[model samples]
Target: MSLGDEPGYGDAPRGEDGGYGGTGQTRTRLPDRAGDVYGGARRGRSSSRSLVTVVGVVVLLIAAIAFANRGDDESAPGTGDSDKTKTAPTAASGEQPVQSTAGGIPAGFAHTGQGAQSAAANYAVALGSAEMFNKSKRDAILTAVIIPSRVAEFESSLDKAYTPGFNKNVGLNEDGSTPQGYTFVSRTTPIGTKLTSSSADHATVEVWCSGLLGLAGDNSTNPVTNGWFTITMKLEWTSGDWKIVTHSQKDGPTPVPGDDRASSADDMAKAVEEYGGFTYAR
Candidate 1:
């Protein structure tokens, strides 16, 4: 399958200061063939290997589901005077907002449920970002947003996923570079966030997001296209901040595609270059 063909795969926005942004730029039109944009020429992988890869991904997802349900019995909602009331998830927090960052990624989230939601939303943007395709920036993002224990694992997984062939498939060079004259667009916009569960030390949050991916240029095979997905992150309060422990995504609660005229490659490229992404707050 092409990168765009991957069921839950999505992209994040490039920020003004070369960081990942919270909101993805809106695409006014749909591509004629979204799959052609990301999954065009195949890099020669054998059918057998491709089948193995698919099986591996399925196994991993099954394991993730089992892990997510592991503590369900023990984590039932509490109802007693001694138990603290679980705050309902909201789109924004009325409390003072977090204002600090590490490596340009949001940091210093409060210990409240709202803070966990914010962290999840921002982390979703970071994970889906174009920066994740670059080795150095990808490492920095992993260190900044993920818990120390899982940083190495996340880095390795991403490195494997964004291989040279995959880079080429996305219209990037082997080293994750944009070819001259072409603009690479990969951005994710979070619609909202929800706190599935939270505690003083641990939290689970889900971010609903839409993204733009592909390349734009004259005669470019892959024109910018949009996608929707939901990212679920498990967070832990550590080192005075909320850090990601685990994350998984699923195909979205997407709406019907609208009837809008697709923009030209030049127009899409110009829009990406001129527009800047936002720093998300919840």
Candidate 2:
């Protein structure tokens, strides 16, 4: 979501500022038919079709095996560079993890691929938080996570993103305050992180995340809803910590949504209040 903008719930707000921090509407679909949409009994034709499908699959499997083995005799294992095999990339190494925090954000990550992944995941949460709308907290987060030189430029860009009109559109006052009797909800949950590239001083990582945004109140136009996205951060090792040099986000590697009943505004507000956020790690 925009640093200061609020997402419009039901109707689009007047002006160009209606959209908040990349938040969008989620459409719900109903099932096409009642129970037993597929009949219990299968006809003879269907059974024949299934048998043919299985036979075709078996044929393909046999052909694939033959193809894989055709050139095995020409190139034996360990014929290539032994060093390449020893240093081949792996998902995990079972190394002791670096776990620490600065200003509530995960810090003290090891200067390794895994450490870069951990830093990116935590930075995504900090950047996507509702606190970003508040100037002081936003500055604090930026200062903690961002590179020393780029902090000013990033803060200026974010200030423009969170305009007064945007705040009003998302059911908040111009100053980013929740309206009377309403609870503003904006949260980001990072599901996982991947290390795209890394070096001695620089690293790039992507964090897959789902976020909740909007307002909760009686007759509230925008209710809290979830959206999936991925955040990529370029980090540099500076001052003994991994600091964000740049960051961007895009629409997700989202999964197909499951059927679930939507909760009432009151329930949503209560849940946001009761549930605490997390500090993520890889």
Candidate 3:
């Protein structure tokens, strides 16, 4: 790679000064990928990746080491007392309005409020999914969840991340293959969702989620990865439903974990392969 060359990683997060941050920038005079001075960054990514994996595995272990801790009741389905208090719709016509659609994914949802929150929660699940790392599978995900207009952009951007070298770097087979005996698990559980603001045709939704990522196998570079973050989605109303338009992420309102016995990688992988995801509502 050229010293001044910046390898694009899709839409790199814009820094506070309105320029993209990270080792990928060329104007910043950052150390090159192969430079000894930049070695620390490579180490940091490796360490952070490993930490995410350990955290994911440790969460399972914690289930067995139960102890009392006080926190908000987050497992509930809806946003708040008012939402939980609403009755479920009995018919399709009774469903809420459309906000936005890219290809088929929900985008720019109605500012009706609830739909945006719902979209954020759902989108976080889709983006954090194991399938998002595979092109064909990711296409299926985009078809199932993304808004119609933005589908092409999402596909094009993510294709770079799921490149053959990227797959190999993440410990998957070069063809994005999962090892026969190994189970690859990735999932996101929404802790809660809230509507930050809304209008008749647009709304901003925020979802606090916990995610897990990793492959199950001995000597795996990509063990399970875990992280807690809040995803904010901007939605619009279109046709007769809500849809997602823009999305962003931040660290979290993370909580301390309790002690628990962690499960073996094999068991975690097996459970992931056997279990399926659900369409979340809030």
- Identify the candidate with maximal lDDT: 1
- Could you say which candidate leads in TM-score? 1
Summarize candidate 3's per-residue lDDT along 38-58 as a digit string, tens digits: 422222234766789899889
lDDT of 1 by residue, 121-207 (tens): 888888788888889999999999999999999888988999999999888898899999999999898999888888889999999
My TM-score estimates for the predictions, one after another, are 0.67, 0.67, 0.59
**C-alpha RMSD of each candidate structure in angstroms:** 19.2, 15.4, 16.5
lDDT of 3 at 168: 74
Candidate 1 lDDT for residue 86:
40
- Across 81-188, the per-residue lDDT of candidate 2 in tens digits comes to 443333444333444445677778777878877778877877888888888878889999999999999999999999998889988887788998888999999899
Candidate 2: the clashing residue pairs are: 1-21, 2-21, 9-222
User: With candidate 2 superimposed using the best TM-score fit, by how many Å does residue 236's alpha carbon deviate from the native?
Assistant: 0.5
lDDT (CA) per prediction:
0.80, 0.78, 0.67
